[model samples]
Target: MAPSPVRPRGRGGYWLFLIPGFVLFTVVIVVPFVMNVATSFTRWSGVGTPTWIGFGNYTKLFEDERFWTSFEHNAALIVAMAVVPTVIGLVLSAALFDYIGKKFGPRTASALRAAYYLPQVLPVAVAGVVWNWMLHPSYGAVNAIFGTKVNWLGDPGLALATVMAIMVWFQLGYPVVIFMAGLQRADPALHEAAEIDGASWWRRFWHITIPQIRPEIFVVLLTCTIAALKVFGPIFVLTRGGPGNATMVPSYFSYLNFFEKANVGYGSAIATVLALIIVVVTFLFLRVQERDS
Candidate 1:
């Protein structure tokens, strides 16, 4: 008689379950990405047959001063969003974790976490419109607080800064929640040991807290960098990349090419470049984190 055949289970079943998800992901993500790259090498006006243009679109990017400016603005946004908010969020998260999570117990901590996440639950379009009114200069809450009538969105000098400020306000909450989760997973015995040793608050944070949450730091940095790189809604709503293109970024520039200017090829080229930059930055960050770890 033939030996009984072995049946697949556990890992085999998991792999089988993942097939549908993998197929859907490839269809939605990989196909579009390849199509975008193909579009980048062709001169296409959405409705017409695409003509091969070699590197013309890419060469044109180097000569376009507005494109460079937009790229520079995006770099600035990446730095601000990655560094500034991480610092602020880390400090606030540490404080909340200490005060609410540790001292006041789980119930209060859950309530506080819910409050911080409220802004993230709101739609970006609504947030953009609300921020536009809040920073409207003459009639805005910001000006009213400072008691000075200054053009926030209308002035070229202030437009970029206003957009940055709005981004910081909205983006901070999600990171705070991330940090809190990291804090919850940290070993409590480490804190107890530090307390017994009479370590100062700063000493404890620098030595114990940060090293334990290194994974979270990497996550927050990468997420914030990607989000900032593609910022558009607030710029569109508040300034329309305006007051003479002072508030423009790569995402808005690409949108203009595709929608307003009707140059699909140029837009795809910009998008491809943006995608390359994101991939490179994320790769570098992961390598650095691995080295440090």
Candidate 2:
């Protein structure tokens, strides 16, 4: 009889590779989040013994008009950062790839892509400073160009809109880059075949291109929506959630409570609620994607 073949080793060794990542995640994310959730239930001022006040912070938060207003602003930011950018990026990426790259050359297409992505690479602080200078009512470049003084960040009526526009500019580049990359994976033959069948650019875009890049579109929308929700850097740098809280977002509101107001429990409650919203949104997006797939 032939010797029995040696049995193969199990794949159990692969489990070892996850140890480092699991430990890091537990220490960094899990621990902190659990602590935050616990803190949200108590009245703490960042020091001393904490007073237990279960759901009090949440109750107060729901009753605050500022909290509602901040959420409203976040909804606008979602439109600016996620909705507008995805639509515009899809069109721009298709035009650049199918039209410009073919007509003018890859070099021209690349240059335009780089220009669009430039703002994304700039440091937020630097961008904010430049924008602030350019929008200053007294001696701004925009005012000089238009021959009109406009308080871009100081006026309550115009501040949120101005921030939304700025967010659109900053966010447009991200989806453009992501969608262009996704388009590279698409079958060029489909577009060519559609063209051969006398399909217009819009028709091909609607029928073929959109379906091919559906996954990328979903990814961009989900990530951008989350980014818009937690947006703090731009608010901190540009408005500090001001013109009388006109641009107050949940993240900045939480920040103000944590540091300025020294209401750690309230801040933690805000953060916890924000986290829950993000988790719910992510779950819905994943469910939709799964159903679509």
Q: Which regions of candidate 2 are displaced past 4 Å?
A: 1-23
How does each model score on lDDT? 0.85, 0.94
Model 1, residue pairs in steric clash: none
Residue runs of model 1 more than 4 Å from their true location after superposition: 1-5, 8-27, 99-114
How many backbone collisions does model 2 have? 0
Per-residue alpha-carbon lDDT of candidate 1 for residues 131-162, written as tens digits (9 for 90 to 100): 87877866888789989898988899988887
- Residue 41 Cα positional deviation in candidate 2, in Å, after optimal superposition: 0.8
RMSD (Cα, Å) for all candidates, in order, is 3.7, 2.9
lDDT of 2 by residue, 69-156 (tens): 9999999999999999999999999999999999999899989999999999987667777788888889989999988878989999
